[model samples]
Target: MAEGGKGSRSGSDSDDQSAVETNLTATVNKVDGLEVQLVLQVRGLKPKGGLRSFLSKFSNHDNPTDLCANAEFTKWDVTSSSLSIEICVHTEKERKKKKGKHDVNTVNTETFTYKISNFPSEIRPEKTTLEIKQPPGETSYSFIVLTLQRVDKSVSWENFRTPRNS
Candidate 1:
């Protein structure tokens, strides 16, 4: 029957959709004095002109296209203290700049302030880690650990302050 054939086709389409995989990578950089930026890059999206592409436009699903990174810092000096910083980046398509009559594509970078206290107070760089959770699907409940090591070895308290007058 025609209905049965249509149902089979839909099932096949769903299978093809599930076969699409999304890959993400996170990187951290210290741009300025005590200013740290975390960048999340997403790949493996369905190309233009396809069923998946059309469905993505209509669906309200929160795909991994957009990602948010949160950094939590914990320190214990007699008492335990914590600080949290969150930053989010929208997909390339979602972030478009209007240049005259046409839209211009530009590299999008999301940034958040990272306090020096987040790192151990020492002369050497240290390793810090954060976990990223993906959206619900075949890879649902999955977590990715991002390990970032400070690249600057000369950061110290003296560099952060000016000399006091006697």
Candidate 2:
């Protein structure tokens, strides 16, 4: 009975270690690809309430107005020291008037474009500020951001890189 317990414990420990190794190996493999810039532009519009309310309760507010863009480098093979991304904004106005309806309603449409690449600078430094605001009664929401993720190229490569950091 004592021998069986010891064997089971050893097997469990080995399994745990194997799982950890597999996860680490997978993460390293993901980073081996050439790094590319990812420009993620997020905009907030007035809440169109429905089943979406259950999922995004926070976005619903009376005065909703704010937009943000985030930049990151990933999804490639080259190891780059710098990254750059660009965000562009455009607006369109639509007039809605009915022949037998009450009045004309104007709709404002906003569009954003993201240009991502691996470089050393930003396309528009003034527009790239971390904080943005909308006028009047400003209702805003922000998100937790992630910068970078380490990728392992090879076990041999990691062995050398790990010692340099220490």
Candidate 3:
């Protein structure tokens, strides 16, 4: 009977983990030229007493996705348009330096932001790709392949300099 109970508990934990993964998948959208936003809602992760507090030390809800963007600079003729991307983090940090007040570990109850810019304009169409790699020891990743239609709106922020034949 004890073995059965342990198996059931493990199954339940697996279900919880699957739910957490489903919640983490974010939707990406273009907020403006050279800017995009990844949006998601996260909740319901409570570890045991001391473990909860201990694990919170490594949690960074802001920019949890660790999003990164890339483009081919050799295929297209790009002008200097100051291309850039930004991420906004809405969580508050625990101020350990302040005295008397207890430090509060913030959760992912808010949105986070990240930004990257100064992309070269000489991007080409040599199979440009955008990938979001998972953190170390993780098994999942999100990927998007470049196509003409996807590039049309994505490369609209700046003018591209057409590639020169070799």
List residue ranges in candidate 2 displaced over 4 A.
1-53, 56-101, 119-137, 140-166
Best by TM-score: 2
> What are the runs in model 1 whose C-alpha is more than 4 Å off?
1-23, 44-166
Candidate 3 residue runs with Cα over 4 Å from true position: 1-82, 90-121, 124-128, 138-166
Model 3 lDDT tens row, 129-155: 233322344322222212111233444
In model 1, which residue pairs have backbone atoms overlapping below 3 Å?
Answer: none
The numbered model that scores best in lDDT is 1
Clashing pairs in model 2, backbone N/Cα/C closer than 3 A: 28-152, 33-76, 33-77, 34-76, 34-77, 34-78, 35-76
| Local distance difference test values of all predictions, in order | 0.29, 0.24, 0.26
Ranking by lDDT: 1, 3, 2
Q: How displaced is residue 122 in candidate 2, in Å?
A: 18
Which candidate, 1 or 3, would have the higher lDDT against the true structure?
1
Q: Candidate 2 on 70-105: residue-level lDDT in tens? A: 222122122233222222222222344568754333
